[model samples]
Target: MMPRPPAPAARPRRMVSAFTGLDVCETAGLRLAPGAARVLFEQDRWVFAALIDAHRMVLDRELIWEFAEILNPCWRTVAKEILLALLAPQHEAVLECAHAIRSVRSPRTCFRFLQQFTDWFNWLTDQGVTRLDDVTQHMCERYLEERHWSVPVPGEPRRRLEPDTMAEVVRAMQLPVLYGELLSRDGCTEGFAPWEGKSASAVVGLKKGGPNRVPAVPDLVLQPLLATCLYLVNVVGPHVADLLDVVRAEADSGQDLPRVTKERVPAVREVLARLRAAGEPLPALSTDVVGRRVGRYGADPLTHLAWGRLARMAGASVFNEYAREQVLPEVQELAAEVGIERPWARQAALIAQADSGEQVPWTDPVGDEDLQLMANYVVTACLVLTSALSGMRTSELLELSVGCRQSRSVPGGGIRYGLAGRLIKGKRFGGVPDEWVVIEQVDRAVALAERLVRRPQGAPLFGSVGLSDRVKNLRGWLERTGNREHWGLPVIPQGPTSPRMLRRTLALSIAERPGGLLAAKIALKHISVATAEGYAARPGGSQRLFHAEMHAAEEEHHMKLTLQAFRDAQAGIMPAGPGARGLIDALRHVDAQLNEAARTDPKVLTDDRHLESLLRKLAKALHVGPANFCWFRDPSKALCLRLAGTPDATRPLVGLCDSARCPQATHHRSQRPVWIGTITTIDALLDSPRVAKGEKTRLVPERDRALRVVAEIDAAASTAPAGKD
Candidate 1:
């Protein structure tokens, strides 16, 4: 029967040779261990483990890629040559590459870049083009135009490639020409340039300053998710910590039992006496374990006893047959006197306030498994809280470790909090050390995460689990535990969620407030000066997302002011200033358009879209000032521009503007309060006996001017048709 198993297969041996072509790893700035093999083609796999950092998100398998794994022989030949050139594009074997890719630091990134072209290589094979020189511009253009590079997946629905994905595909096409010179003689495409040298973005039809598509977490979803997370961290976290403490104590108290002797009876009886002295119930199986026992043994009462708990309490890992047989009746009597409580937890159940204003238990009685689940949920909660408040990228958040919380007292009084971590984006090899200045809540969240998981000083707090999945699981757990309903938390709406989305949400929210654009820039740690300025100069800057949100806020701000002006004019409260006539005329024109539209559809006057469209032009001309609104319809007529001697300036110079004298500026009742306050301040100063002669002269004219403006505002409001004032 044992016809002798076939002789064991021998392990394949790798052939090593003297280094020949080039030290591609050294050229790419990868440090290899001394005395390591440098041969390239002889070995199918090249290990770069020494070059990769432990904290890097890359997998261990990716450190040593197997070039031999590429099934297509022709594709494999070209891929290997292309990878070498990309690693050292400045080498003598490569032609002039003005936009040469900087050295690829991550092997995984390089691997993906080469792998992106497998489908295209197959297309080339089908066209009977075996050599790189045969890949012409026409073939490249056809590949892009027909989307031949995208292969259909088995179960995914067929859809057109996303613009970002397509952009990457176009880059893949250009690589053949970008590194073609470095290829072996037969693999070189000496004269061909992909798509005739046009940029990848241009080829993909991506417009400059196009709308940003990064999804910000919706407020409805974020608000509830954050509320629940905060509750978990502050309210329920202590109880969870207590439960974990019990588990740890039990685990650390090893199960090595003392040798059994006559003293066992006295020890067991003494433990029972102590338990009875205290009002505590006997330790028993959790409800879940009881259910499991009932399921297995047909609901027999004897199957539900927690013998292991009693044995552990009696200075033994488990009870022997002698103690069980002799002491079963006493144990039954003790169980009847004081009911059994769950062995895993001794803390009181947490109370949660329901939406209907009723107090309820946060969860059902928890078993060991349930306690572990709660611990995991608490970790997810901490992650959500940190990400929502810190405005850090996913990679940066994942880079956080135990004891990363940093704090220092400020000069004045309050303490500033920060998290020390490494930045993965735009860094070479191991990420550069960086720190995020955060609020107190974020600092506490990081601390809680550390406490939940017992990691050493530098051990990573969060894993590489998909953040989207974590959020989904968090919401599911909250729902299943009735925490959402009982705690009065809003239902988190369904949507795409990631750390990037959370970061964008914080940026978008901050970008909408006063002086928040600069605050958002600082909060997001956009440290590059060029990146800050590129919003005005370059279309696709690093701050494009922030720029887009800020620009939208600006547009919304102008529209709100213009709409208020229109509503005031409709109520006959005319603006009173040098530019009052011009402002009145503009409002009348917009009102006329609204009335004209309302003739056919009575609801047109009330429809937001209709009103917004009619007022958008007037809104564009409005420039809000500290004490006045500048209707800058004509830059040539702006007094501030004339005084500054900048005829071509698009925006008004608010510092130089004299609103009372400038024909483009207007003052409404809303602005009159500032003038009134100024008048009162000057009056109070003029009335002071310590007033100097020079101060008196300055104060008299200021008070008179303010009084005149106030009178005008008063007259306008009193004469308004609504006349409520």
Candidate 2:
């Protein structure tokens, strides 16, 4: 082996001021605009956009790294140099700092870490630590301890940081150590290798699999919430559309356009004539507004007429000073005759009928504010329906546009519905075009949403509002007494809900059915069942339901049969099969328990809960089949296992099960339908001309067996006294 050369000596400790002339962006090899000047370590801020492509996340105001927030100029310069090294190419970083950049992928990642880093430095500053090199291990450990239950923001209450958040804080501390050589001497922490070389995740003890902390919306809240939203979109939507059309037609008729008094007077008189004929009152202020004007401003209640509404209806800008003097007296006389109650001239009467048979008007009076509020409610309903049914993320739903609905016919004459939208999750540069297969309800909701919020073709259907806030507003609207009582909507249970929760809820609901694992995987667009399983097993998700549903179904089927048999025994019906003796004994045991319980309470036999517990053990032994119930207490006598030459098997193979002759199987009234169907099938086969002698012989025996089972069931039913059990 060759001898090695001596290692180079470390650079001497120095102040960040010594590196003032360094062009940090150029050193990091960041992309730059044409002829842009270099960003130096001396500056208090770094405008990263001047050096690279526009960031997708940061707003225009956040384009720059404002090191001024650090307060100390020396610490600011050191912070910039350390972050610049993190931005360097992997090879460059390895050459300079002797460590490869791992955590940060883009400037946004570094930007997220910056705030926590600032908090830690601010805390250090408060401790009277003047420089990074003076940051001792004791101080770093103490900061971690304090942050475990500290106020995250200035005015917020104290909270223990979640595992994910604590991990981020630990990563912030480890970054300085990773780039210690790249930082000035005073910038590096004097620690004994932060956390003793443990990774941030290990130190914080984050779970191995990504544990989705977002919970599914509980069924109690989701059921009525979706029901009310569906009512708005499917039932109330057309009325809103018609009213909006009327509103738009009046607005677009050029009625509100500027016009001379002489040209508009006849139009105003014509509107009055129509209102008089229809017996509609002129628009007026509400009682509260009338009182406010009379008491506060001392104006006559008669002068509170909505003259602006009249002017717009008559193709004039407003009821001007001259026109009001001319029209005021005539309007006052008409108001006194007909009375002014509603704000709108034409109302949608009886929009919905309550369950108690009360006719509900769309609204008492559709004022401008009221109309807008109804329209907003319609939009909120559409949003809720679309999110719950389609499981689309907020970003994807916001990317939906007008006329995005598409449909195609399936082979079975069914139409498959889909909505065209952009997938905003993985694709960064203009999102990838995708289509979501949805139910008919979501399609109707999208249509209603388009009508509520008018947008041109290909324009975004919804605005970029926070989904959480929108859902909160929707629940608030539903809680209003006027809206609830008038609309006849059910009470929406209170709980936190969001787009992510809706998505996870959809995943969980689908995963709790038979053959639902595959359905959930497809519906959620997951690449594998394992991924869907993880979603179903999330914290506060449907883990219990997903695991227990299949077993519960089998157990429920057994319990039903066991309970029915006991009822038959009470009615003088008896079992008659190879396994009849065992089934009769089990029924006798259930009867004995009921008799004992009835000693204390005469109604114990009628109690379903008490009966269930008594019969539960016997129910577990009953394995239901198509034509028989296998009392599978002992696997040694299982006909299916014996025929398959595996008598030690824990479960019987249904295909090989000869329930008719099995000693552990019994037939009852419930099996009568299967026996009748079998006989019908055998008779059909025997009557066919294609039957050979051997096939006819086989069919005859099968038909006879089915007839005998049917005879036994009929005899047992005939012997039971009518109106007994």
Candidate 3:
């Protein structure tokens, strides 16, 4: 003011431009004059409002500030402050670059920096990092290095990048120092100490000259890994599409992905089945068979062995391991005692060699004494193997019902029941009925199933009849009932049995048996021959014959006896006569006593209390007591003897009544009433010389009538009042 601004310092007239000339005002449709500029500025603020609206769509809202810095360098200080406050240090560099591009007076300088910044931004976006702070310098460096790295060229002596010039151009750009810092933080630095000096090129192993090679995996290990993957995919259940994509990618890229055919699956199954059957630990067959069957596909024994090992490692069963360890040793011992060469001795030795730690083979033989102890186990195993070998599952075994039978229509003869089974393995197959089958083990299983049937239609054949406690205790019972040596059977394996393994072993056995192929297929209810064929190829077929013979006769006898006893009980309770009358009368008397006591002393009349009291009295009286009522009627004498065979038989009967107002009262009148009767016909029958002449005969009806009259009188006296008019 003092200087008067020196005539406004010869001020040049300020240029008046259209608001549209300014990008911000142009975007907002506003004017540039001071008065109108305020309104235009406010209108331009709506752009920020629109950004807020678009926030969700933008992966990184921080990028908007950088964009702002690039568009208006005069706002660089504001943008820098906003970026520093909003983002990490790495992001600040990006914003600075953007600001430099916008602020540069030369158009060429501005264009060059803009191009560099844009390219860097696009790369960060591709890496899923939106903020400059999020994209580490190390990552950017590694990315550029990856792009430039030369790969081995097939049929060429030297290596080269696919696009040779592209890497050089990218490397020439002046990338910010923060790029390297970010990369170092992310552990992407070339020759990083922790990375063992592996540059990006070295890590990827890109070279120029040789054919593209894939790594190889041992077949044994590969099979199990593949099987495990399959199990995880199929049994555990996961995203199939995602898993398949991964597998497909890995396979196409020649990664060590597992490959298995349908044939190989069964072979693997057989190996696992054998290990399970033996109840042994898995062996390392992968090392032995890796290169033997590289391209060929079928049942690979080595693959099977490897799978078994994997299955065990995956916690298949401890009992399985115990079985394997115990079975072979026992078998060798038995073979030596019996002077027979161990047929599977080499197999046993292989197992021993392959065993790590306490793993051993079980080889004890079945004995007669252990038969009952291991009956359920043996029977269940046989049934399961029979089905598995035939290709049947547990569900099918459970679905069997009574009357689900096959009948053979004999030509010009009556239909005979051949075999009976409900839906087996979810399929229907007509065959010989279990009753007709000569195999005792099978018959026992069938009988058990029949016995457990609750409905006429069907019943759950296994684990339906008994309590879990009882089933669990079956192992302990086996231990006590059988010799220790008998616990180890080549087929049965040592240790506790599970329903699952039993079924598997059964399948195996059926597969190995002669004519077992068809029989197993029918038993398992399989739709395809191939499915059943897997079971038939198991190792323990010959053992089944022994099982069948060992159990058939004894189980049949036990079953017969059990049925006979049940029928006898039923028949015995059906007859009506004096015997039935006596039992009914005794029960009625006990009930009356109980009811009276309950009425008098409610607290004292629990079921246990009454039962205990009644049992004690009855036991004392039966063993040693005053003979009171003679319930036993002597048919020869036709006498209902009261106080039978007692010295007081002829004494005057004492009638103690309950009612106080009775007229024929005596000293014992207050006492409760006890019935009075006499053996009137007994005196004459005993005194008669003719009857005593070493002869016995049924009494006449007159004598029976006389006894009946006395009994009726006694009953009346007990119920009616004394000296009734």
Superposed on all Cα atoms, the candidates' RMSDs to the truth, in angstroms, are 12.4, 12.9, 36.3
Better of 1 and 3 by TM-score: 1
CA shift of 513, model 1, Å? 3.1
lDDT tens digits, residues 1-725, model 2? 99898543344444443345768666655667887766777777777666444423345555577888875656665567567656654434334665546433456656766777788888888898876666667787898888788656887788777877788888887777776665664555333467787988898788865545667788777777777787778777778877877777776775547642755777888888888888888877644455576888788647567676778767676766676777667777788877766465355568654335477676667655456667887888888878877677776777778999877776757666678776655443235666776777778889888887777887767765365677677767656526766677767777877877887666555443222222221342322233333235343222223234335545755687788888888887877667888888878988897888789775635458788998898888876666877788889988888889999988766557676688888888767887898999999999999989899998898888888888877776677787762
In the range 672-692, model 3's lDDT, one tens digit per residue, is 122112244454675687794
Counted clashes in each candidate structure: 0, 2, 46
Candidate 2 lDDT (Cα, 0 to 1)? 0.69
What are the lDDT scores of the predictions, listed in order?
A: 0.69, 0.69, 0.32
- Candidate 1 on 553-655: residue-level lDDT in tens? 5677678878888888888887888898998898888778777777866552445777888889888888767678889889999999999999899989877
Q: Could you tell which candidate, 1 or 3, scores higher by lDDT?
A: 1
Off by more than 4 A, model 1: 1-24, 31-42, 49-55, 90-99, 102-105, 122-129, 136-156, 255-308, 318-340, 344-365, 485-488, 514-725
What ordering of candidates by lDDT runs from best to worst?
A: 1, 2, 3
TM-score of 1: 0.67
| Model 3 weakest lDDT span, ten residues long | 663-672
Of models 1 and 2, which has the larger lDDT? Answer: 1
Question: Best by TM-score, which number?
Answer: 1
